[model samples]
Target: MLSEESSTSKENIGLTSSETSTKPRSNLMASVELTGFADNGAGTISATLGNKANKDIAKTVITQERTTDGVWTCKIDGSQAAKYKEKFNPTGCVKK
Candidate 1:
């Protein structure tokens, strides 16, 4: 016969094991777009990732130019050159 304390400990251990086993791996992706304009005539944009751990994984820049008609055109530079290295857990696999 199992004591009440032993039974409770077994239940706790089982719950913890199940919780850890059921945790899904992270599926992360990131994208950036120009969202607004700055006071210095520069475009203000933001880059974000699905995982907070990847927020600072890359550097970005915005470029703006004035046309002959006094119109400003904004674009995202360094975007195409950005690279992402995806990481997988347990085995610590890295995919580029």
Candidate 2:
């Protein structure tokens, strides 16, 4: 199991410049391969508790795949992806 709240560093994707600690953290659930991603497999999930004030939690089923050229791609919720595409870059995520 992964920690919901792990020590973060500046290199971490969501961390800001003020942060300086360093440690590799798993952003996605376990992958079938060494790449830390899964395309269409069972037992893959990621949960996030957003914000400090409100207890808003989101449990997402991670879906990842590699292109023919070997580039990593993923899928988020279709509607959310459409709205947040510019910022979130939900590439290769198609409506299901």
Candidate 3:
């Protein structure tokens, strides 16, 4: 049984491991690759992003969107600074 917190978190994020099928959009021009993950899954990707000085300072579930072109784009949530973080900045999320 999922706890209330877990259930609410899932609802708020709106993503599950099983929902990995994605279709490319007509507008995207670039064609990259996720390397190991499903090539077509373009949606929310939740991951724990941390800071250098203090890991917990910016530690949060940073969600990136794998666009139709296969690039992981950052989606900012609240004031969490998920977009400005090092790993997600400049290059975007790499499935490591």
User: CA lDDT, every prediction?
Assistant: 0.33, 0.32, 0.36
Q: What residue runs in model 2 are displaced by over 4 Å at the alpha carbon?
A: 1-57, 77-92
Q: Which 10-residue window of candidate 3 scores lowest in summed lDDT?
A: 24-33
Highest lDDT scorer: 3
**Which one wins by TM-score: 2 or 3?**
3
Rank all candidate structures by their TM-score, best first, as comma-separated numbers.
3, 2, 1
Please state the error at residue 10 of candidate 2 in Å. Answer: 26
lDDT of 3: 0.36
What's the number of clashes in each of the models? Answer: 0, 0, 0
Better of 1 and 3 by TM-score: 3
Please list all clashing residue pairs in model 1, or write none if there are none.
none
Which one wins on TM-score? 3
RMSD of 1: 20.2
- Cα lDDT tens digits, model 1, 1-96, are 111232322222231123324221323324333322323333333333343334434333333444444576444333333453333111422221
